[model samples]
Target: MNKRISTILLSALFSVSAFAAPTSYSVDPTHTFAVASWSHFGFSTPTAVFAGAEGTITYDAEKPAQSDIAISVSIETVDTFVDKLTEEFLGEDWFNAAMYPKATFVSTKVVPKGDNKFAVTGDLTIKGTTKTVTMDATLNGMGEHPMSKKQAIGFDAETVIKRSDFGIDQYVPYVGDEITLRLTTEAQAK
Candidate 1:
């Protein structure tokens, strides 16, 4: 190739690589999970664990506004500590798992709030109802995997939702309507 043509081609390739961001990453189910807790009877406390979920996370540190994430949680895998309690909670009175078998969250916007923080606005679907929820998220950081030497990014986020908003209005006077959720996602370069 001619010298000038070679230089221009090389420049274009370098720029494309610099701007090309990983578009998606498969969630490591073993490493990612959702933990949520709330008051039980205003005295006793309870927690449910969500397992058997799969999703993809799309992110670019330079283009936070274009970042996106989506996850699917299996309602049938909801664990509530006690069989009876878990069954009831997953039934029509709470999550209605019998009919609405899955919960999902999809990001609509990701805006930088400050200092490695972001305001993530998304739609959360529970019991077949979709509600817009905003959460505070942080890009915990990124680094190379010690074993794979691949790029990885860590993230953490928290959000609160009202169960009643999704028709889960049981034990009103006792159980707190406000439910808080915490999530952590570690994404590797693809």
Candidate 2:
């Protein structure tokens, strides 16, 4: 009877440890970039690069589902190359930087697709509007960062979002409703 009880307790403990928490990481701004591209009149495509983002990542390799991901972008850093357009993006008709200064994404779920690939679904908030968005993510690499002297991970993610959904449809059908985002990040374990 005593042996059986001990075995049962051990099994329960092992089960709970199956989803071990992952390592925590801090976003390395110098090595990360978030950029968006939208079409113009269905002919020319222009890109807007977000200069920097700050975030934390808790990654789990054994239990990928247990990972936590969050990213916050400063709207003021949006660079569209054109001085006029850059200013316009923050106007009341668009992102409205004055009202909502930061754009944030917090992961709700992570689905593994094998081969270091994952589908990250989360809530993306911009200009006081929140919407569910999914990004195709790839774990590019995991190693050490020479400068930071810590374990580091690299990721590449891509997602398509509708500007109209976020209430940024200033130009609407004319300015292109769909926007494609390509983001790359290198984070050092904290």
Candidate 3:
């Protein structure tokens, strides 16, 4: 090819490649978790955690609003420190893990809430029910991983949802109808 034509093609390729790569990161499961707690008998109680979670988040600091997150948690992996209670939670009485093994959250909008904080609006699906939940989040900043040689970022988010709204209202006056959730995620570049 002629020199001028070759130059044009190279420039086009570079520009195309620039937008082709989206900075993505994986949730470091060891450093990440989703914890939910509810008041027991109208009093404070130990928290319950949903273990065995895996997910990914893609973001661009330049365009903060373009960020998106997808998270999945195995319902049966819940740890309430009570064997029979955990089993019952996974049964038809609670999460129904047999039929719906996982719960998911997908972001639809992200709004800044000041001081590295944000309001992440998304649809949280549990037990085949979908509810629009706003998760308060904060970008814990970015850093370079010495071992993996990948960029990593941290985030902390929280949201509260009423269990009765999602058809998980088995507890009634015993267990609070509201569930408070907190998510701490450390994502490593993929």
Candidate 4:
């Protein structure tokens, strides 16, 4: 019957749309940065900015849960504003940038939290140690970029990680074992 054929055709069309492939975007290193902050000896909080992030983000606007991200931050790019402290961080006492060189995060799961927010669980690796961590992320904006004239997406995420877990616990209770990481990124379709 005509009605039966129409129903089947409609179902097939919906199925195709539902299973559409996600879009891939290359991270814009110039617009992506990560800030790591920790309490320094209970007197003040010191923050360092890690620039020049590189990675890919596979995003599905229709089904955000299917989205995933992978990013790498170079240790050599860390800047703490103080020349002495920055040099110290690159040494063996802290991050040991010579050995690590980079820190990375690869998402394993993306859970939508409504209102353009998501709980992203991923494996974070630092100094060759990997640990599962979750970041509270928000989709900042998505559309054609003005400067690049390309489809672009932006996000902001925050997570707390313990340096001790990654074998970088120098002062522990004194310098604060837990470090807060905030990431802001913009990616463009490649």
lDDT of 1: 0.83
After best superposition, candidate 4 residue 88: deviation in angstroms? 0.9
lDDT of 2 by residue, 1-190 (tens): 9999999999999988786668999998887778899889889999998756899989988888878789888888889999999999989888888988888889999999999999999999988999999999999998788777799999999999998899888777987899998879889998
Ranking by TM-score: 4, 2, 3, 1
- lDDT of candidate model 4 versus the reference: 0.94
RMSD (CA, Å), each prediction: 4.3, 6.0, 6.0, 4.2
Residue 118 shift from truth in candidate 3, angstroms: 0.6
Q: By the lDDT metric, which is better: model 1 or model 2?
A: 2
Ranking by lDDT: 4, 2, 3, 1
Using TM-score as the measure, the top candidate is 4
Model 4 misplaced regions, further than 4 Å: 1-20
User: Per-candidate TM vs. native?
Assistant: 0.83, 0.87, 0.85, 0.89
Clashing pairs in 3: none
lDDT of 4 at 36: 93
* lDDT string, candidate 4, 141-178, tens digits: 99899998998999999999999998888778898999
Pairwise lDDT winner, candidates 2 and 3: 2
lDDT of 3: 0.85
- Candidate 1 per-residue lDDT, tens place, 97-151, comes to 8898888889999999889999999999988889999989998877776766887
> Where does candidate 2 stray beyond 4 Å?
1-21
